[model samples]
Target: MQILEEKTLGIKSWSPEDRPREKLILKGRASLSDAELIAILLGTGTATMSAVDLAKRILLCADNNINRLAQLTVKDLVKIKGVGEAKAISIIAALELGRRRKSSDADKPAITSSKLAFDVLKSDLTDIPHEEFWIMLLNRGNRVVKKQKISLGGVSGTVADPKIIFKLALDELASGIILAHNHPSGNLEASVADLDLTRKLKEGARLLDIQILDHLIIAEDRYFSFADEGLL
Candidate 1:
């Protein structure tokens, strides 16, 4: 097999219609393949490899799984040939920007179901290396007022203070809230501490006339909903 150099294999070599960036501009982002989307962000590769080829190699490192991009770190990315510091930073930044954009778009609409709630919070929470407690404050109409990270803690951390969780909600005059936390181990199962914390929050919310809509335990690619499982 013959080796194709970067310049020969690059999007620059393709007709404008075939280039990922040009195609995206003409046809929209949804028209691009995962590799094509990634290649556009990568910009270029080393002299020996095209950006698209490098993107394919990077995706293959994650088992050709686009979703696994969330799991990649800058260190992991730099291990790839042709992915120097600048390219690695660009790739990671692009992925994070996409994640933030998706979250913002998804959160624009009111979360009406457990599934929708899970979808909005999973990406933000599940990959967190440490425990984070997020309070999703909702208006009387059940539309989200805001989602705030109330606290960050260590492994096996516990945050059971209803006052801490509800202070912001009360300040915003929120009628309801969802409690969300992540299990860094990627197990969606709720621990005893999780159950206890939810129960306490429910009681506190009830006393304050604020509804506890749900408690979501987020993990990679999966989540546990207290309301969905009849635990709340």
Candidate 2:
């Protein structure tokens, strides 16, 4: 009879070097593949699948794109056969920690250019299915005082309420503001509503004595900056 390495044998029967946790400890984190790292987070597997095998299935759902995998909701993960709520939560927590670390590492203390703005914002906006509007409230020196979410919507677009925006800026005592939103379709072009909103906000900012410094349309890993294009 052929030797069975799967089923009840599980990862325990595998050679230490082949096990994700043991490999991570022996070989260091850099030596582990993406699936291996995820397998460690999963901790255990189903009756039919090993932890590594189950993690591979999860990666397949994201098409092996780490960015897309980070975007998955807890509900999206639990739908997978072997992933329970606890395992799904662990995966989400690990991804979120990595994301926050990345954002902090890319931090720009001041808002001097659109490129810097994009660098700071892309961590929050990229690799997601929905559209979200956000703003950076800046002081007189163009230093970021606060970053706030304005609204969220479906894949096509989101709404930004001028009244709420104005209230936030005024309450923060911001002297300038930068508007940004994501395009889940990966199209960076500003739609008509985007243009109209920009115009209205510019006029409102003028009345409030606040400078409308820039508007950015983020898509995927790239960004479209209105001020850079002389659209402001």
Candidate 3:
């Protein structure tokens, strides 16, 4: 009976050096496998399986793709046995922290032209399904201070208020600003409303002594630049 009990003790039956937490401490976090890292987040196993085994199953379900694992919703995670709400939340929080760490470490580059602006923002805006207006605030040397989402709306259009924009500019002490918005329809032409808003924002920025660099209309694979067209 002692042998049976010992056999059923799951991860504890392994040597201490083989345990995920113990291995991480001995070899440093960078040396641990993906399953071991997830096992640490889970912290415990089910009655029949070890935490590492469960983590391995989860990774296999994602086809060993880290991005697919990161995109898993809590509902999707809880479909697996032993991954209750608490465990699901823990996994999600860990993934989000990793994403934020990468974003914080990335250096914001200077915006030199409309082409550069498109290159910087295309990846973020191109695949989004709905309309979103974003602002890139810059310092005196054209280095990006921050990127902020101003508004979100349906497939048609979104609103961008001049007062709210300048408020953020005031808060960030931005010397120059570039406005960008996406068209979900994949149309690169600027709408009448788009041109009107650009003019209003330009007039407003001039009053505040802040330079309005350009207004960009982002589509699926192309963009329209107001400054490049001599509209700014």
Candidate 4:
């Protein structure tokens, strides 16, 4: 096995024209291959392969499924042939840091309307494989106080009790809330269960004085707002 030293098998091995970093600099990040993009994070590899090769192997382990990357734990990364503790920790830390950064950015704006609520939750909920019910907690002014996942299950069968929903709102001291759920089938239309749940929640919220602002059904790149349809 050829050991990959910083000088030998690292970025130094690639000619100026063939180097990923240089190519990214000359062109753009969009121009880089997936292996190159991952290799930049990996930094280096073991004796048997370069970082790019290691990245290719990692993607292969994911069966080329990008979402599978989210499922990977530190132990899973370390189990890969060339990924040691340092590399595994670095990768996991990078992923987590990115998630926190996105969440922080998402948390900045208050969700006043159904449109605003959808904007805040869409990015996270759109790609989910299963149905996830989330509550967007809002202050008296309608700015977002926090967002919390209330439950998860299949599309038509997911059940989220009003008590469970209200508990989090009470805990957060939220004056208003938005209910959001995803359709795994990529259909934004509300099911009968969706409408029933929304009606039930709105009735419950009215009694508790916690306003139900909207019920949004999210699919890929599309969404249905009950409020927009005068259903709220």
Top-lDDT candidate index: 2
Reference-based TM-score of each model: 0.86, 0.85, 0.64, 0.69
Q: Write the per-residue lDDT of candidate 1 for residues 38-74, one digit (tens) a residue.
A: 8888887667777778889989898997667667888
Q: Write the per-residue lDDT of candidate 2 for residues 1-232, one digit (tens) a residue.
A: 9996744669999999999999989999999999999999999998888898999999999999988898899999999888999999999999999888876733357889999889878887886799999998899988888888899999898999999999999999999999999999889888999999999999999999999999999997899999999989
Candidate 2 lDDT score at position 163: 96
User: lDDT for every model?
Assistant: 0.81, 0.91, 0.86, 0.79
Work out candidate 2's RMSD over C-alphas.
2.8
In terms of TM-score, how similar is model 1 to the real structure?
A: 0.86
Judge candidate 4 against the unseen true structure and give its global Cα lDDT, from 0 to 1. Answer: 0.79
- Where is model 2 more than 4 Å wrong at Cα? 1-9, 104-107
TM-score, candidate 2, is: 0.85
Q: What is the lDDT of candidate 2?
A: 0.91
Angstrom error of the Cα, residue 57, model 3: value is 2.4
What local lDDT score does residue 140 receive in model 3, on the 0 to 100 scale? 98
> Model 2 residue 6 lDDT?
46
